[model samples]
Target: MNRSIDIFDTTLRDGTQGEKVAFSAEDKLRIARQLDAFGINYIEGGWPGSNPRDMEFFELAADASFEHARIVAFGSTCRAGASPEEDRNLRLLVEAGTSVVCIFGKSWLLHVEKALQITAGQNLEIIRDSVGFLKQHGKEVIYDAEHFFDGYKSDPEYALSTLKAAEEAGADTVVLCDTNGGTLPHEISEIVAEVHKRVDIPVGIHAHNDCELGVANAMAAVRSGCTHVQGTVNGYGERCGNTNLCSLIPNLQLKQDYECIPDEKLEELTALSRFVSELANLNPDIRQPYVGRSAFAHKGGIHVSAVMKNEDTYEHVPPSRVGNSRRVLVSDLSGRSNISYKAEQLGIKLDKYGDNVSEIVQKLKELENKGYQFEAAEASFELLVKRMTGVWEEFFKLEGFRIIVEKNVSGSSRTEATLRIKVNDQAEHCAAEGNGPVHALDKALRKALHKFYPEISNMHLNDYKVRVLNEKDGTGADVRVLIDSAEHGKSWGTVGVSHNIIDASWQALTDSFGYYLAQKQKSIQQKEVI
Candidate 1:
């Protein structure tokens, strides 16, 4: 029989330790629901007693009926010389109303002596008492033996004693932590094997990524018979990071045939990873395994052609299995298949025997030589295709626009924008004032467009990115702007470029509204047929 492995997600606890990443109570709740939906075995929320936000999170999350995951409150073991009943943090962990409790205790003698200023025996008592108290309270206790690998190396007896204390005290799982994240994979396997021999209860592995071996070490521990893997989604944490469950879950289930996360919710992996990143206000790592933006994006001609013939030739796994899609990028390295694939995605019909593809491929190469990157600006590429194929119809025409910005000595700025636009034979002039010239321009443009197209009111910019083309001095750099907009749960992107930043933003902003309008038109036509 294959033993089950517990996937403990620390996104709320360790993932929040990432620089400038903090989830509000609402953010934590949203992530919790999503994690539960993804079939994670354990969700380790942050230390409730640490801050008001986390405290409120536990209070609100207490009523949540997680379908697959057990909510866990994380904190340190009760302080030395303190009763578990009297310790406020331990009490807070209990009162948080989670079915599971994870408490970290000092495993290294150096930490017992220096950090806690307690004797090794006193530290062991803290671990034993805390686990025993929580277990008595009918909570499944998980003792995270902090710095277990380093401590075991420093003084194997003391570290092993810590596990023995927690085990004897009734910890359901004793997790060994490489707290400093400096352990190698070989060292992890050797130490975990020894600890497995010493402990009777289930053993867990929690490796950090300071040496960038967190995932490797965690896998090695599993191979050595660890039944639980602890990590944050997307490898988020302080310093380097913890082991990444995004990579670990798939590796365990698909590669090692371990039953970690449920097989059905595997498709939610991509969305949940991105949703957590959005809640944290951090950009998702595009290169992350399974769910990353570039995980299945093909750029080279040979790779693209082969992927078109058989995706398994270039991809490790099918993207749809993880709620992601493969992308064939158009670059100088792209072949005819890449152009065809991209064209089809843009809703353009092309004959496989057509000669227009050669023209499109050559144009893509010419644009790439001119510093126009379609990989990052796919909207621009789509517009280029429409113009080349004469399939695009003009929805509105730009007459003229100008913006003025003034900065005063009082550290205040003012902007005035004016625009003239024509819809068919009708012309409209609009002006708006804003905090910045770009904002003012956007307001004026939308105000004018809303007069002719009421659907423009439903569109809002989701994200905007600006990049400089040249870094050399004394030369004006070309600016690129990518704009994301959404309406009715459908999102589309548009790109713009110019020597002026404001101009580039205006172009992208205009395209954002135009894309929505175009999509609405397509939907209406489809509805008419139905």
Candidate 2:
């Protein structure tokens, strides 16, 4: 077996079928270039006949040069009664102008009988005709056997016959698809092994994630005899999802000793996953394997200690291998080791605070027991460490603050906030209006501090979330507010907890400002010392 496998990315086509997933023709081009740069073998642009947007992408991609990947247009085979020349779908595939074309044909008897309303022989004829037609146009054809797994289980002979039809018709590759995504890994391995025996051409696998086994099934197929694997980045597709190339690539290259892409390009996997998710306008799954924010994050004290000593103790592979970093998170479960690890990560010297590290752990535990979570609020945790070390200085002293919310007769609302603060014995007072109370407070505080510390103006709150600690307390429940503030391209998270939501927001808001100012001062001092 040639250990080298062909990777086909369907993110632009199948991925867009996912709910809330939308991409423009330009976005598809951008993604196609990225995939090419990563050395993917095939890029399925979209079903050109299905939409004008897909055709637009294909037309735009015509002029683009890719070093590795061949852009492929996807569509279905000719209609049962229609000849390949008269088929609009096949015509669009040719018009797509790509060197390679992929077309799916009915394999399941259920779809042939009910969906297509065609006889079994007719389905086979269309499959053969469609592949032959694309081949006649000087295009390499990849025939997708839709619902192959279920179809094989239902009628093994007929399913094998369909593969034979496409293969005999000069299809470059025949892909078996788990269209409904319900097949087991063992079944995939068995079926793929059988198909490889019956077909001389290379076998491929395209598995969906309905049963959360898409990646597993793809692995099985490869173990059997598959050389081409089809998937989407981050598993973005209809219903559950498609096989996640993000997960599969690493598993194949690092674990299974398969060559999916260039060895050096393996490290770019995490970055590519995040890039696609960003372009797709979807939040990256923090828990996703290999590419997620939390993939290598350690929170338990023992785990952190072991990982710090020997990362391989707790991690399956070095996170850096995938363009990801290992993170030591501080929470109530953290011990002195966790604090030491985190301080080292932040470049904070803890040698002077030797015994004080224990106190820091105690304080962290106490705070977390009171509805304070440091997992997402590393900025707040850093400040806590600075304060415990007696190296933090008070940036400002709050005197008083008040907020007023008024509703008008036309269902309109207005909010205003006023605040007083002392900056090095200089009393500053200011007032500002905003759409919400938190926004008003943020505006007013910046207004008061802009003169003493104009750098505060550079930072703004980008995200805010409030979680009620106890719903049993209802209106009086304690709330934990997390605020994400960004300065230029950099960002940090701060957190605060209190009985009143407004107070909680105020605490997080203040911490966010305080963290930025402190970091700015440290940076300036470092430059001065140098």
Clashes of each: 0, 0
Off by over 4 Å in 1: 402-418, 434-437, 473-475, 500-506
Model 1, span 409-525: residue lDDT tens: 998888999999898879989999988877798899888888678888887767778878776722488877787777766677777778888878888887777667777898899
lDDT of 2 by residue, 374-395 (tens): 9999999998998889888989
* Candidate 2: stretches off by over 4 Å: 526-530
For each candidate in turn, the TM-score is: 0.92, 0.97
| Every candidate's lDDT | 0.86, 0.94
lDDT, candidate 2, at 157: 95
Q: Which ten residues in a row have the lowest lDDT in candidate 1?
A: 466-475
Return the lDDT, model 2, position 6.
96
